[model samples]
Target: MLSKRRLTGTISNYRFYAQSLATASNSLLGELNDWETDGDLTTKIGKSLAAIITSLDALQHFKAEMKRSPLMPKRRNADAA
Candidate 1:
């Protein structure tokens, strides 16, 4: 079983990672605006950015669920083996 302190640290790390990714994404958008490019390249960049944001969102959701649920990673039963 994971201790409460360790679980809290893990969740905090996830939150920090998500926030950093969001900030980087915003920076990418700003650079794209400055580039003023159009068509396929722009579409590709937009799609990639969207994918990254979606992944971060999923991580955040997972972290929230972990906090709410009683579930934790199953430990090995040495005696049963």
Candidate 2:
């Protein structure tokens, strides 16, 4: 029993979270790259890489859900905005 507005709000929040996750993953990957270059791949760096992989999986799932949801359009172009 969710109102349309609330549901849309939920989706918007999820999208925002997904974007944040992507940003975080990118940042982590950058750190990982730096670690690799320095040859200091410690346990913490490995853990961060693992976390990035997990987040990427979750991002794919959320992206698929967003595509399937009625609230999302099939295609969105930046120039269209």
Candidate 3:
């Protein structure tokens, strides 16, 4: 079974990756908008990219909320009682 600390670390890694992917996708979508003509294919690709970015953003927000909630274990310092 996975320990709480390991599970927290895994979620943190996932959140980091999701943020990275969302940022990259947003940048790419911006470049595509600036360079590509408004054709059916470009439009479809843009829509897909938008959907991906939205999903990633949502995942990050969910992770943040989970971290703030009481269910996640709080970090402790060695000096604390």
Candidate 4:
């Protein structure tokens, strides 16, 4: 069985990865918006954007679930420090 500290570290890494992916997706969408395209290409871009948005939504849900998991460490309040 994994130690609590190790397990927490792994979960933290996963959360970081998810955040990185979301940031990258947002950057890609911004770049895509700056591009000028024809009707066919526009349709393809729309589909791609939809897929990216769906993936981001799923990641957000997963993060929320992780926050609710008992194994995850509780966050400290900065003001209480």
Question: How do all models score by TM-score?
Answer: 0.48, 0.47, 0.46, 0.50
Which candidate leads in TM-score? 4
Could you tell which candidate, 1 or 4, scores higher by TM-score? 4
Residue 66 in candidate 3 has what lDDT?
70
Q: Write the per-residue lDDT of candidate 3 for residues 5-33, one digit (tens) a residue.
A: 86677677767767767776776676577
Question: Can you rank all candidates by lDDT, best first?
Answer: 1, 3, 2, 4
Name the weakest run of 10 consecutive residues (lDDT summed) in model 1.
35-44
Question: Tens digits of per-residue lDDT for model 2 on 8-81?
Answer: 77667667767766776676677777874765557656766676666667667666766667665567788989
Give the worst 10-residue stretch by lDDT in candidate 3.
36-45
Compared with the true structure, the alpha-carbon lDDT of candidate 2 equals 0.66
lDDT of 4 by residue, 1-81 (tens): 345686577567666666766766676676577677544656556666665666667667667766776776799999999
Pairs of colliding residues, candidate 3: none
Positional deviation of residue 67's Cα in model 4 after best superposition, in angstroms? 0.6
lDDT of 1 by residue, 4-58 (tens): 7867876787777677677767766765776755545566577657757875886
Deviation from native of the Cα of residue 40 in model 3, angstroms: 2.0
- Taken over the whole model, the C-alpha lDDT of each candidate is 0.68, 0.66, 0.68, 0.66
